[model samples]
Target: MAASRNLPIGFEASVAGGIPILRVIHESTAGDRLRAVHGILNGTANYILTQMESRAIEFDQALQEAQAAGYAEADPSLDIDGFDARDKLCILARMAFGGRLKVSDIPTYGIRQVRAIDIHSAHRLDSTIRLVGSAEQTEAGLEVSVRPWLVGCRSMLAKVEGVNNAVFLLGDKIGMQMFYGRGAGGDATGAAVVSDLIEIARDLAAGQLSAKKVSGFLDSHDVGICPKPRPVSWYLRLTVKDQRGIVARVAEVIAHRDINIDSLEQEPHLPKERLSFVITVEPVSEPIIQRAVGAINAFEFMLEPVLLLRVE
Candidate 1:
């Protein structure tokens, strides 16, 4: 309705707080075709992961501290469970790809399963974990998801610690650009609100309301899902009852699926009743790896479900 009436509508604060990421995609990169838009969209979740990494604490302890520090809500399911990021990703995907995207359609995975042992294992491999939301235009379609990725120490995602956000934009003409700042705080959100108002006032003084012509915001076209996503490395952590031939059995399952094991390690000097096994597999599509994971999980020695993570 507002667009039809040539009314100026501002929503700069709706996405990443105070970063002006929407404006960058809407105005600054208008000439270029956006190939991808991805980043850490949730400050609360980022804070929790960084806290666990720095303090060497469990997810529960980190949640308590985040609540005490006023970084999280009493009902933090939206943030910690990855739905908050999912909603934001849908908006960004629509803008970047110029199509209507349903928030529920995108796949989402949270950091709730992350444990202290996972963090310890990540440190040993010189990597850390971050909840990332990504959307990219592919030959098949738009590939999108919100999940925890095992990022190396030197990567930009790992550098964004605490209650901060970072957004990366890829374009054919502009190449790659990054936007980083405080994602959600009273000050940051307020600043964004004021900036939007200032723009509206300027438009009013000009005697013309700005009509938003963004394709994704106005178009009703549906974005197609990528049928087969490109292959990537993966990390699988399994806790199981100690017994003979466990490794052989797990290897057989992976081999049966035609997936190669990149590296496998068992934590030293653990209890005989329970042990931690970390497996790194070579690049393979999600479906094939999942099949192998299902086979391994069905074994009698498996104590719990496998924790699978994407390796960056």
Candidate 2:
């Protein structure tokens, strides 16, 4: 209650489990002109990667180990799948960008599907996998997406290691600033919550709280979601039951779609019952490849949906 905490401005904690952090300070606006915001907010992926590094285990196995250790949950989809990252991003975006936004409105893609092969590919190019939520000013609106990306080695953003959260801000004078540290764990986020509360109390005492203090998140233009997202290479993993004409059928599908296969590899020693085929495709829009995948999934002999990844 405002009486107990002397809260007239407000106090609302969210999906973050920081034992009620005062993560709200965006209400202050008497001077700030413009701001940029983002968050690296998921804990599961961070924890999984840390486990992978420590145990020298594959990502999937590391995630499983994290789940068993209670560092992850029964259904860690929220964390691993990218929703958790989006929620935290929503809060940060509202505070930093001064915009109104609902968590659901933000597009999200999880790292749950990232296999060791994908991570390996990222590193081969001197990159590292990171879950990033980005917002950039544009002619239409703010462009944003929560997805796994291969951050270039040259990017300081790439320097962020496992379980560490980092945020970048760019503005008139602020130029470029990064808030990097414990993205998770009770200590880091909990400290953030407490700090928020302190600022809220200070602002309320100074009569700086105003309901009209606006944010552009929801109000900002949708920024047209980068439709027809620029052509990018892709990684496709196909599982087959070792039936006849499997490879030929696949090639035909790719050809019909006007997509070029850059390289193809079949892991040696794969059992006849379950063979893994990896396909690297030249740069192309996603829909083109999705059609090909759709047709491939229709085959009864197809093991499951062919896994697809947008290559960096």
The TM-score leader among the candidates is 1
Candidate 2 residue 234 C-alpha distance from true site, Å:
2.8
Badly placed stretches (over 4 Å) of model 2 are 1-39, 53-60, 68-70, 91-101, 120-128, 136-143, 151-158, 169-177, 192-214, 217-224
lDDT of each: 0.79, 0.62
TM-scores vs. true structure, each candidate? 0.86, 0.67
Q: How many residue pairs clash in all the candidates, one count each? A: 0, 11
lDDT of 2: 0.62
- The TM-score of predicted model 2 comes to 0.67
Per-residue CA lDDT of model 2 for 64-149, tens digit only, reads 77677665777888778887667666655555555455667787887776666555555555655667776655444555668776
Candidate 1 deviant stretches above 4 angstroms: 1-8, 11-17, 185-215
